[model samples]
Target: MSVAAADPDFATRLNAFDLAALVYEDGIAIDRLMVDFARGLAEAGRRVGGIAQLPPGPATEPGQVDLIDLMTGDIRPLKQRLGPGAASCTLDGSALAAASTGIRRAVAAQVDLVVISKFSKQEIAGGGFRAEFAAAVEAGLPVLTSVKRSQIGGWLAFTGGLGTLLDGRMDILVDWWAETERRRAKTRHRHVS
Candidate 1:
């Protein structure tokens, strides 16, 4: 269900086939939120895949790499300078390759949840982590991501009407996770039987 239509007891009402996306407005600390959520899931013994953006260093340098693969806890650089400017930070193709390698491996190993940091401009253009995202969906893993409100159209088109939009609230996300795990467990039990 979409966040706008979500009930207070949504955690107990979600379907097994639900796929969710976090819709965030600008200025929200989405990357930090993703990292924290993933850490909590990992600590709770969930096998989380995909990547999260690490917090920037104290120096505040531009063009710094910050993507961290959740599966292996590998901190990798995914930023490159586009030109000689102050805010020319762009996605580094090479770094994306390295990070995707880790994600692909995680998908192959069947992680319980996949946390992609964001679906940004590159993803709209059919690049970036698009392939890994498809892999997670095809494998029926619970996928979590953030999307700018402006890019909601692109995100919708990409997911083919299969994603639930969630508000960028921690409580909502926690409920979503609980529902996802419950659905997954049900699926597993059905398969085993």
Candidate 2:
């Protein structure tokens, strides 16, 4: 619940890295990571729930990728945990076609918290915190994001990087929010922190 500032120099650090272009590299894993993140939040407490969007064009990763192993390996098991305070949403069509509408749906559902995980290259390219993501962020959505730190520029990059690239910390976020008394129960309106 603290309004403490995150590492202010994070964006400056991420922009300087010499990472390769992530577009074609491990692209499938990107989507998988996002989906799994949403799932993780859903698993964290008694009232956590999710609204998943399947991106157009076979959102499923390649069969050989062993997604089940990915879900259970290293990362904690999402299905095993359940909290009454989290929810995830998945879009059925192209983001351009459905994301805005989906936002409306969330508005109608009275879900005040939303997290957009940048767990994949595709989503990374989708302008993570721009006119689109920014709309949600501006709306005060609880974005669980993953993005290339370089693009967001300035302090936002580093501070926002967790929402973009480092989603593994979601468990900690869930636990922290719970302890802060922000989430009264799963499915209950969260007190924005």
Candidate 3:
């Protein structure tokens, strides 16, 4: 994956901010970090939208979790139970479809930022939230998402080098959001003038 050097002002130059995958080392709580970051932005009065993953349940059941709708605290299950093991579980495409509907609404509503929980195996394989991601980008909406180190290749190719990889830092994300808002405001002002 091509790592772009952190450019603090990069968001200011673009109408839409397509974030680079937030790469974290093994054992890092990247999911939780993303949840907290999205919450922080919303609490700070930014009109954040899209989905953030809810933490997985206890270890007795791995890979079982729901995604939270950022605008509404609705839960969408990620996998359907088939049996006891990881192999028993299969992705719940219906749930994803429901969530995608919400994302499309969010984009149409022009939310300030869109937080896709992750660019995962499904997305890389041309499934999952890939369509929602494309819709958000097509609408020129700023998007933030986490990408596993292993899946960075697909993420890079999918974003076509337009994404900025962040180091999972809350401050850095906040800076990008601020710059994006600034750019949006400037664009609005220019249109009015």
Candidate 4:
């Protein structure tokens, strides 16, 4: 079911836009939706770039999350334990920097789409993939990301109310990708000509 269905203007917003946020409440499997969306696009021969977050596997450490690079199929650990004496954040800074490089490559290649896992607390604080997001937007790359409901304000502010808000559903993502891809193709053709 599409959460955006409740909003009458969602369909109008979905068209003619490249930047989007798949917003979800806490405990929703937003990452799964993101991975599935990116994977489906890649399978359809689209050049998808950026990283999607995955839950830690059985062999992964207790607090370790994973990020799968869409362009390279690489799975890297995204989070680490900061230990009992440390504060709450567990994001692996170096790992995120590595992921940012992938996004940069995607923008350079003008990939069909770029998927950043989420714009949460890190991005809200002007860190995380914020720079990568800015780069993609500047290059006119279609960028999709997941965002928690609590962080909607930050996502809106960052995108300057120019992004479409998608629900946590595969169908919505599929539709959005189709429209964005068509729009991007037209834009690219114009630039080429």
Cα lDDT computed for each candidate against the true fold: 0.77, 0.35, 0.75, 0.79
Model 4 alpha-carbon drift over 4 Å, by segment = 1-16, 56-61, 81-89, 188-193
**Model 1 scores what on Cα lDDT?**
0.77
Residue 142, model 3: Cα distance from true site in angstroms:
0.5
Query: lDDT tens string, model 1, 1-193?
Result: 2221233443344343456788888778777788899999899998888888886768747647588989888887777756666475476778889888877887788888888888888788978888887776666667788899999988877765557899998999999888877877888899899
lDDT: which is higher, 1 or 3?
1
lDDT of 3 at 141: 75
How close is every model to the real structure, measured as TM-score?
Answer: 0.83, 0.39, 0.82, 0.82
TM-score, candidate 4, is 0.82
The TM-score-based order of candidates, best leading, equals 1, 4, 3, 2
For residue 91, model 1's alpha carbon misses the true position, in angstroms, by 3.2
Total clashing residue pairs per candidate? Answer: 0, 41, 2, 0
Deviation from native of the Cα of residue 75 in model 2, angstroms = 24
Error of 4 at 12 (Å): 18
The runs of at least 3 residues in candidate 2 whose Cα sits more than 4 Å from the true structure, single-residue gaps closed, are 1-30, 40-95, 119-129, 149-167, 176-193
Give the distance in Å from residue 128's predicted Cα in candidate 3 to where it truly belongs.
1.4
The model with the greatest lDDT is 4
